[model samples]
Target: MKRPYKKTDLPVWQVRKFLEPGPIVLVSSHWQGKNNIMAMGWHTVLEFSPSLLGCMITSANHSFDMVRKSGECVINIPTADMIDTIIAIGNSHGPRVNKFTRFGLTPEPAATVKAPLIRECYANIECRLADRRLVDKYNFFIFEVLKAQAATYPAYPKTVHYRGEGVFMVSGKNIAMPEKFRKGNL
Candidate 1:
């Protein structure tokens, strides 16, 4: 009785917009002893064992080139207070402007990767490039999380999610369904 699903052609921009908000990741990469940070909204956990994560960086971004050359990156998860800084970094080009200096963000040496970590962020993950072919065709990069740590946070701290363009939303309230409606309701 269910309607048959149909595939429809859509532009990449449209497809990107249709997807829900994703976690904001501050990706740091180093090359030639110079470091750079880029605000990325497209990232996700790919595996548990060995802690794998996937991220997408536009081919045109300066950070992409650094990652390609260094084969390492740090994924920093910032709290709500960092929304402004994140937006500023995302809106500007790293080659033209040093985001760390412009935003007054500290660049601390990562324990496992050549890239640095955002000191202001609540959490950070040091990763090495596990796969690069994904970037060749889709501008996506896969990383194997080598180490991770967290700063002090409340039981529930507000996190920012990028909605697109210059828009962002904070982590909202939580909801729990009744046991009957949770699973196997039918």
Candidate 2:
């Protein structure tokens, strides 16, 4: 048996590579009669009650202006089957490419907001801006989830995660923890 082990310092630029595995979500925004969709990978769960979440959208993105003005958006979670479409959607600019038309995606009207939900995605979360304190400095928007919908086959639904630089990975295997969560006092 032969084993090879090596250790080397990772480049500063590659630090993002370690944080790249977060779930990828398609953010759709509509304002002043214009709508756009952008794929993003950097987001985090901020709270449990009211479902607070935070996501970063660069000021350069086409959806940024719309979302900032509207103060609402939909976060659509795509399954592994839509990996190619997800990549295509993220690779092209929204202004030039009508993602719905170019990527063959279906847009369904959302209940609480103008942002359309991608019908092809396995899950959709409607969110409204909860705080705008970090937008100018970090392009981060804090959202309070309004509603959520998910497919029945949530166990191992093969969702994709970004690995940086045109790389992606699909979700696999499900595990259940034994401990039960304690309810927090509101």
Candidate 3:
């Protein structure tokens, strides 16, 4: 058994550094002949069946209004190698900049949404707004994944996850123990 380590009080706002879930995905939105990409880390998988994903997009973000009005967006998972691109996109403004052109990212037409997929990313999930109940209160958007695609070369791409305050961690290794789980759990 391992020994318990000493603990220290953490600020409530800084708790995200330890509680941040999932990878930093690039959300693509298109509305009124414009397309934009923004990096998002505040998202979670709500359900497995029908593929529900909940993302918190601050109202101040340019993609928020575009996604709200268009009712659709594409969530693209980028590999760890594209960390620089992700940071650039997150730091830049949307309306004044064309991310696809500025970042030299190829935009491919999505099958179920107007938003284009980033060809360089490992996977792209097309989503449609399913619920807006929390949008006004928390700027949260529940989306039902309509279509998903991924690269077959790497079983799982090395994804980058935020740790707050300009720090990031890259996904490493996979430990599969499906047999240890109860029948349908895996």
Candidate 4:
């Protein structure tokens, strides 16, 4: 029999911490020809065919307005070396500051979207908004990946992952399962 659900004895935050870490993506959006970027830790892959979905931005963020209006964004995955730049952009308000200019970051034109990609980042995933209702109440934006580009960093293949408020961890090691398990045999 299944055990009863109990909240009184469990630490909910600890349970959330158990999830597999994902990359720290810098989501760029353009509005009225002006561009902006903000670091986001809440993003995921939700589809394969035509590629789609999942990004979360607080309702109060300025980037939220830009993204909603433009319907396009570029997700740039930075490296471990970009921690300082990521923290700076994540902590500041775009309305009051031009992060790209202030941080000495370079922006490269994206092929399919108005939003530009951060040149220093390791990877760029250009996307168009697939759904905005996701952001209406949950602060999440679902998008369809239109294009992707990666820097020539063969040594460090993965992107950075934000641990919490100010802590971040890099992709450390890789482990592959046996072919039997890979095919659901084990």
In order, the Cα lDDT scores of the candidates are: 0.85, 0.86, 0.95, 0.82
Off by over 4 Å in 4: 1-10, 155-158, 181-186
Report the C-alpha lDDT of model 2 over 1-186, residue by residue, as the tens digit. Answer: 678879698888877767775688999888887667888898999999879999999998888888999999999998878878877777777778678888888889999999999999988999999999999999999999999999888655777887777778777876665465555532
For every candidate structure, what is the RMSD over all alpha carbons to the true structure, in angstroms?
4.7, 3.3, 0.8, 4.3
Superior candidate under TM-score, 3 versus 4: 3
- Give model 3's TM-score versus the native structure: 0.98
Residue pairs clashing, model 2: none
Worst lDDT window (10 residues) for model 1?
177-186
**Per-residue alpha-carbon lDDT of candidate 3 for residues 107-183, written as tens digits (9 for 90 to 100):** 99999999999999999999999999999999999999999999998898899999999999999989999889999
lDDT measured at residue 38 in model 1 versus the true structure, 0 to 100: 92
Per-residue lDDT value at 158 in model 2: 79
Where does the lowest 10-residue lDDT sum fall in candidate 3? 13-22
Question: Clashing residue pairs, candidate 4?
Answer: none
Say which candidate scores most in lDDT: 3
Q: Report clash pairs, candidate 1.
A: none
> Candidate 4: what lDDT?
0.82
Cα lDDT of model 4 by residue, 98-155, tens digit: 8889999888999999999988887889999988876788988899998998876575
Q: Which stretches of candidate 3 lie over 4 Å from their true place?
A: none
lDDT leaderboard ranking: 3, 2, 1, 4
